[model samples]
Target: MTWKKLDQIRRENPVTDEEEYGQAYAEASLAFELARLVYGLRTQAGLTQTELARRMGTTQSSVARWESGGSLPTIDLLDRLGRAVDVRLELVASHHDPTSSKDSPSCAVAFGAR
Candidate 1:
């Protein structure tokens, strides 16, 4: 058995069926992005997980889960997190034309210091 790089493996067997994997890929990407955002917010606020959880009225385990991307936070939870971190949270939705070359419709979360 020989070692093969991930890029080499991907090049050998590319994803030919976007329909089968697009949704999963998008969901994973969003989860990763959200995890980074949560971790960033907590760190920037100089708060430990326990402190952040206390401020949000949630458990430290829940904060860990969010930071790990193991769970997706609800809108209400996001609002609480924003308040806990002293940041303004904005959720934006927009439609994208399927016929266009652009990607599908998606939502975004913007954060600003309060």
Candidate 2:
């Protein structure tokens, strides 16, 4: 489905209708984004999931799961992926006060490939 359609559906029947569901949806979206990044980087480097997995000392299935957004890698695995793909993942966390709408907590991930 198109993103617009998905968004319209979300507006009508949001997966995040509740606070807990919202949190879960956010986490899942993050996972999917991470998976897409991994797939893109791997392909850009001309490596198959199996080759990338071998470089990371894991199995192709594990890499597939990561790319499929079915599972998340550990911090250690993330580090390995960064190294293997010659990319850097920098995360910055900014604190926010509950009363300040402009200063809400935020996360920034910078992806730089060397």
Candidate 3:
């Protein structure tokens, strides 16, 4: 493919409406939240992920995965993460009801990944 074609592909696509814009906003917000959590934890410990891993007796790759949410950390790992950041990740229930209940938990209702 030509450089021009590649450049065009790299450019942001236009959003057509409020619905599309809100969807994009939600996805981007989730990504930002994940990144921020990772960064905050590492920085609070006054260490990079590598250094924090060293202190936590784990591999930097492990930390990297958790930070990016590529892999969810275990409860144990989350406790360690909290220690590293001097903050806790608490579990809170949503006020919104699930689309599917135990009797009908088969279908998923989402606008998209967002």
Candidate 4:
């Protein structure tokens, strides 16, 4: 029984079927990124999960779920969150060469405190 670093294991056994796992990976990555963004906004605004949820007209569990990456929020929810935190949300989309190794088109969501 030996210890192995997670990154080492991943490097040794990379995903061979991109067609199967690519979409899931991209979705998970986006969820994680959005979770971090939500958490950051809440903390930066000096609000607790309950407080933020109240401001967003949602429940604290919903905020916790968002922060934990358990669910992906919709644009309408994002807009409400931005309003609650006094930040501006900008969603940008860009196309990339399909022939490239990338799995899909690039999209970014920017949050700026107002």
Candidate 5:
């Protein structure tokens, strides 16, 4: 579909009709993305939800909830997941200055090996 058409549809969507709905929609989108990522990684590793939960020292239900987009994982839990799945997790931060044209400072925190 064309960008214009997509934008029009988005504008007409009920989720965007109000401020609270917009916020909830945004949150749900993030949750879905996170769920997809977690589920994909677990599948790629040939691990079941229970197995992944055991690796993460969490419960199967917790893993199921996360994979179902019913809950969000904490940063520490994300780090643990990265290690359990042999992946790297990084938290990057950039400080932008409106007055300055130069690039802003940034920080990155990585979990697991390269």
Candidate 6:
């Protein structure tokens, strides 16, 4: 059956049981994407770990730890990193058409308003 048909059926059958699965998938996906973005931006700026450390006003080892995934950054750090590199991060998102019947629910991701 088509998604539209499935969605119609789902309206009557709300699959509440899958909520935890959907939330975990979303969290994992978002974290992975964010880490990739930070690594990509740092490399594209032609910055060494030391250079990025200087720009971030921290230590090279700290930068290395963050990049190596021993440390994760806060949202505020992400904005600062983008500023230091002079490139804006863009996250494009959209509604999964209501008819899609996907297990994942819609969410708000932090794409810069600019």
Structural similarity to truth (TM-score) of each candidate:
0.73, 0.69, 0.49, 0.75, 0.70, 0.54
Each candidate: what lDDT? 0.86, 0.84, 0.66, 0.88, 0.84, 0.71
Ranking by lDDT: 4, 1, 5, 2, 6, 3
In model 4, the Cα lDDT at residue 6 comes to 77
What is the lDDT, from 0 to 100, of the residue 33 in candidate 6? 64
Residue-level lDDT of model 2, residues 9-106, one tens digit each, is 87898564588897888999989988997899899999999999998899999999999999998778887888888889765577656676654548
User: Which consecutive 10 residues in model 3 have the weakest lDDT in total?
Assistant: 105-114
Count of clashing residue pairs in every prediction: 0, 0, 0, 0, 0, 0
Task: List where candidate 3 sits over 4 angstroms from the true fold.
Answer: 1-32, 97-114
Q: Model 1 — which ten-residue stretch has the worst lDDT?
A: 96-105
What TM-score does structure 3 among the candidates reach?
0.49
Which residue pairs overlap in candidate 2's backbone? Answer: none
| Candidate 3 vs 6: which has more lDDT | 6
Name the candidate that leads on TM-score: 4
Candidate 3 residue lDDT tens string, 1-114: 999987787575555688988987787676667667767768776888888787667899988876775665565665666666566565333444566454434344322111
2 or 3, greater by TM-score: 2
Q: Candidate 4 — what's its lDDT?
A: 0.88
Task: Give RMSD to native, each candidate.
Answer: 4.9, 5.0, 10.6, 5.2, 5.0, 11.0
Question: Would you list the clashing residue pairs of candidate 1?
Answer: none
Report how far off residue 51 is in candidate 6 (Å): 2.1
- Candidate 1, residue 92: how far the Cα is off, in Å: 0.8
Worst 10 contiguous positions by lDDT, candidate 2: 96-105
Best by lDDT: 4
| Per-residue lDDT of candidate 4, residues 10-34 (tens digit) | 8899999997798888999999999
- Cα displacement (angstroms), candidate 2, residue 36, comes to 1.1
